[model samples]
Target chain A: MARDRRGGSPPPTAVSTDLTRRARIRDAGLRLFSERGTEGATVRDIARAASVSPGLVRHHFGSKEGLRAACDAFVLERGTEIKERALFQGELDQPELLLMHRYLARSMVEGSGAAASMFDRLVQATQLWLERHAPSETPDPRGRAALLIAMELGALVMREVLSRALGSDTLSPEGSLRVARAKLELYSQPLLSADAAARARAAMDALGERLDAAAAGEGRPATGAGDPGG
Target chain B: MARDRRGGSPPPTAVSTDLTRRARIRDAGLRLFSERGTEGATVRDIARAASVSPGLVRHHFGSKEGLRAACDAFVLERGTEIKERALFQGELDQPELLLMHRYLARSMVEGSGAAASMFDRLVQATQLWLERHAPSETPDPRGRAALLIAMELGALVMREVLSRALGSDTLSPEGSLRVARAKLELYSQPLLSADAAARARAAMDALGERLDAAAAGEGRPATGAGDPGG
Candidate 1:
């Protein structure tokens, strides 16, 4: 059955051909969707971008919403892929955070990915995934681990924001690289020494306990230590 | 002569609209800008949103771009107002990190200021501003201090990105609020204690110096921490 570009179900298959075709469709979708936005983009626009027929899009996905769903998955999987490759490059607990930041910066500053508008959808998907997987029992260490990892990445963006608000300008490519490197370096050091990491974990655990207690109190619990909350 | 929104030139002080009309125009612009992207929106939209005529929109803003530029400034300024107010609310040595975070989150999550997509523009604008101003420094403590403050606010959006990437489904109101609070808690902690902050800064500085040494030295740096980069 042929599908319209507006939305449809992707064809079911385990073969290489199917995988390659799916990739083609997703790549095209990312470019067009980012450019036109979710509501603005049409299936034909995506098909044209992918060099595939509209029927092929329809034949694979059930509808426009389905294609969007697939695109969401594709962007996410790619984000995961970037995370993996950046970390795998060398031995440092963190390869230069700047390098990783650069990789993301490339996606955000240079390409179709720069739209940054799609972030809303990605966030929504993240919530649904959390609900399904973060079951009560084991703490879902995997998801928790990913969340903490993400906080570090967020640090770079934070640095950029701070720089701009005060400086009235953005980080040039080289400077951003330098600052991001500095942040990543700072983030990396404690981890390098297992002794320090254990100490840090203990401190964090204590702090978390205090927070839990304070939160339970009549009013909001005051977090101890330096306020990183700003 | 009519004044332009980009601050090209203000009309002579003698030519003035009553304060009420000025407020009405700014209000109308904000409403339209949030609903329609800065690009998608027109003067007609602003006027309509304000229940005024397009001529009135021009009379107030001078042109479509002018209105948009003004709107952009308004959104940025409004978001920063609470922080600016709160900065003076506490002692000079250390401020309440939780309060700061709450103020920022309240602005983004609750304000009439542009929501997420609109925020995409604000975040990028801040980055743009950082890019321009950060390297313009001349070893002045004032510049550095200002930059640090800006970096702190930047952390808010940065943390949001991190929480989302980890698959927590942080896009919705509840999830976004939850993640915002967590990040607020994390980043706000440092602002509360002077000694803790001094130590953290010392650590970051040392790490930065070491990174510089490493970069000056050898081959590629180690891979970054966590699964994304690894």
Candidate 2:
């Protein structure tokens, strides 16, 4: 059943025939969980959405919590597969991929232990990707990867605001492309001049040192010394 | 009373002397709202946290909704002031600034009319900042700014996941600096090589054209043509 679901990137209309009943339930669970969050979606809701019985849902996944876990696992696996294809094969226009991204974003926002684990896995993957493919040198590769993941997922989490700003729904194809293009533009070119970045880095380092000194009970008060206008 | 709160970036210990009861309640509201979201924090809770009576809370802000509006306005104004200072004056180490960022992130995640308005204001501010300070030439300056803001605020929203990835609390000064350093590193350099970026852009453009063509009922089905493995 899992293999059937994972085997093909079937069209939405073909989903009914391509997936097993269990896969259908899981897909419904993912959609509801993504849209309404875990607490908002009950077992009956998932069963109804899947056009199955509540008893069948329990028999397959045990409970709502179990169903969520199954959804989490499925999403993580599918997301990894889609991301790998996009990165290595340059296959960027997968429709199911976007749904998976949305699911992951919603899952992370409705945080749980599973979400944290998923985030960590993504960060590790990003860090590895950066180490292998990135042209620029980074002192803290982990932090950079984590930041990148947060920013990307953040866009999904705040899609409504982005859509409002762009006067279109970011989850839609056009808006997604617009966002992607903007991201490409931002990443392909340096936003800050080299000189300014150097100065900012130096200032941050100095501030970090000051913060360290303050933590050590140095001459400056920890919380009050740099009170901008006070 | 409002002036007392806005006048100085007093130390935490001096909060009592520096802010009036109303200001204290507002500040407390901001903290709780930021931490707990709009629904999680209550009027009685805000009053207790501020060490004031519920009657005084009502006298000052009328209701929780009123207090929230007051918080939204105060945060927006203060956020703008801090951002302007940070951009123009290069003062990036203000402690209160982080709290404001936290509050806005929570507000945005909670999603309300006020949150949408605040997001619009932020996008506008970012667009102006990009025009003035960003060296890169962007075809869609609004989209770029909106993306940048989403990414930055997304960091705050997903701070817990980020903290776990970094093994430190991102809200803490040290962790914040680490994240800042990483951001500077990222912003200062192009992640994609010029050749790769050009290729990616070309591919995206081709895909966009195809999507437009498909949307217009040309050569392809809208939903299923590019199903990687199907």
Candidate 3:
């Protein structure tokens, strides 16, 4: 848990040899799962990556699903820890944090109960962050937070395409820095003028009202038309 | 291609019965492919969805891969047409446009050559739009555009989670309007104060220089570490 000069966590290699076998297996699972996804990375692949037998992997986590759950729990816990350190302690340059981000991105794209839970946790955390630091006049704060998180996760999910678009791999340290700088630039200034935003907002409001009226005339529930939840 | 009173394209249902069998198969492919990933949807499922014989589907599109390629081409062409109409003619209220967006989102997440091509096209289009509408002092306009496109597509890719978070399906007309409004609000106002953004930019600059110096000292290519492309 030693902090480097920049207050970031020590590199993974620094403490790699000291980890227990179970911890090693979990770390391997995180890496493989992030890189190859849940289906692409088999138990045999994880076992080989960890320099352990397939049976030992089962002994440690029961099955691939169990291994994934362990990985998910580890990612959630470690990701929160890293985020707090980065936010509160100014440990923002940690490279290992990307692994957690990648794992979560894959999980989110794959979609599962675990992924939904992770996404909800992130939305809640982002909502809290917005309220505390970047408070806004957004009426639907939860929706705003959810949208913001989706945008951030979207970059990770579309990392390959983004990397190509940027003429560099976004996950690399230099490329990561470049992307971060670009985001800082983008968020620092409003993309639309106040007049434009107000006009767009008004237009959306008009559309909503018109749709509601049309639905009422048709004798149908306005919001229930395309409820994917049903 | 008759326009509605609002300047949007006619709804899909209006032309559904007029479509040829080939067109029907292609449309079904687009819908199924968007809902299910490339692997998740099969020729049989697509044929069933289209109410066509599986043999007919094969006769028209050759195979599932061929069907997907045809769908990709159609999405790109139709998406561009819809986008142009939306931008130039104010046809922004078209609900069917969501189908194109969903298909592209799924393709982007699945990551094939087609997906990469589609993403690059989007990045290019976005970069053009930025240059025309919201020019900034960003040194890397391509990177900025790529990030913007990723954020937008990210919303579509994570639509289900976003819908759950917002308590409504984002793909629906009402939910789409809400999401659009939220985006307008977000883009209209700067998320970070100028002072904070400047501070972050300066910090990132310092980090970059430090990393470069470290790389130089180590006699390694500065940007070569962790290059996923390599």
Candidate 4:
């Protein structure tokens, strides 16, 4: 029951394993989660596939839920950040956002399946996150932030599908990011100005806090749900 | 089968059913299509829910596939038209773009099941459309036009899911639209001045005759078949 006690570095655990082994667990988790559904995959299965002990998995993640959450964060937060950076490698020279969009698309379609699997899990998890993270204040956190992330992920994947259909081969890290960039440019007009994007992001952070509180079953409900598209 | 002949202008054989009946069928179809995946639902089921005859369903559309195609057109083509119109609505005054985006969001989220179904169909249909419509000439229509439409549809749906999680019930067609417009602006930045959108769109029109046609299907083949994440 001793802790690794290492700050910054993932601590040593009760069960034997390494960082790469943990990644394998994530890789295995993404595949199973995407194919069956986040709710469908079990921790034991992921551990076995990763060639690790279930005890090790538990020691690392604390629980199956913890592992799922970690996988979601890893794919969406880290992967997207990485892909975005990769896409705009030289936006100034390219000038054409579409070209950059095409390049980033490579990350989604042709990127490692591990990336794609984590992506699938993130989309589904966004909902659960809202459920878990809703604020306790009145009115919901206004899922605008969640939706933006969702749209980004969906667009990323759809770009992959469209690329393959268009005959761009080998959905890979180096494939037609130019084409993907061009495709992404189709979305440029609607982008929030830097100021607006900031405000929106802020609103989202505030909303997330509210959602977390509310989902905890405390606080005034937000009036944002007055909509009745039903 | 006897025609409704309700219009009295003529015994409309093609769209013979009145708007009311057609509306009923569409509403029923949209609902069922959402609940049941494309492969799972049937015309009989749709007609039964609409309280109409299967004959009417068949008469309105040649078959189940045709009906589904019509549904896609209804959601996608019509939705795009709405989206494009909203782009300019707020440019003048009152920030109408926000309303427009919200309205678009409603169409996307409320129409989620339909949008999801449309996409599944579109994924395969894009291929068929290319095959049948791809002209055997020297000018290839730009491949990205249909792809653009498809991507936009995904964006709209993505935003709706966001609205759902944040519990933003005010996700009107107009409000959601603003969000989409903002995103599209960022997406299309490079093309705004250059008329790239226009050129790309026209290319799609001309591509039929002169597609790269590089030995049809010569484009890269998908490598690493089967889920790589595994």
Per DockQ, the best of the predicted structures is 2
For residues A1-230, what per-residue lDDT tens digits would candidate 2 score against the true structure? 54443332434345445668788899899898887667667888888999778898998898888888998888777778887787678666577777787777777765666778889988887787777667456778888889889888887788877788789888667777788888888788887887888777777778878887888785553221121111
**TM-score, every prediction:** 0.44, 0.80, 0.82, 0.39
lDDT per residue (tens digit) for residues B1-230 in model 3: 23332222443454436666678788888888888778778889988887768998888788888888988887777788886776676555566666887888878777766778878888888888778667797898888888888888888888877787788887676787677777776687777777777777777787788778877786433321111100
Write candidate 4's Cα lDDT for A1-230 as tens digits. 22223433345553344446667677677666553334446787888888778887888788887776676566556555553454345222222223323322322322333444444444445434434432122232223334434445444445434444456631442233334433433322332245544555565456556756876886654322111011
Candidate 1, residue A51: lDDT: 62
- DockQ of each model against the real complex? 0.12, 0.34, 0.30, 0.09
lDDT of 3 at A177: 79
Best by lDDT: 2
Model 3 lDDT tens row, A56-162: 79987988899999988877777888867766775555667777878888787777557777788888888887776567978888877788888889888888878
Q: How well is candidate 2 docked (DockQ)?
A: 0.34
> Which segments of model 2 are wrong by more than 4 Å?
A1-25, A39-64, A85-91, A215-230, B1-26, B39-67, B85-91, B218-230
Global lDDT scores for all candidate models: 0.44, 0.76, 0.74, 0.45
True contacts kept of each: 0.10, 0.52, 0.49, 0.11
TM-score of 2: 0.80
Model 1 over residues B31-72: C-alpha lDDT tens digits?
544433354457777666665577877776788767655655
Model 2 pairs in collision: none
* Candidate 1 lDDT: 0.44
Candidate 4 displacement at residue B184 in angstroms: 7.9
Per-residue lDDT of model 4, residues B8-76, tens digit only: 343545454345666667656765664443544688999998877888888877787777666655656
Point out the higher-scoring one by TM-score: 1 or 4. 1
lDDT (Cα, tens digit) per residue for candidate 1, span A122-229: 344443443453222323333433333344334343343444333432243334333433443222222113443345445555656655666577444332222221
Best by TM-score: 3
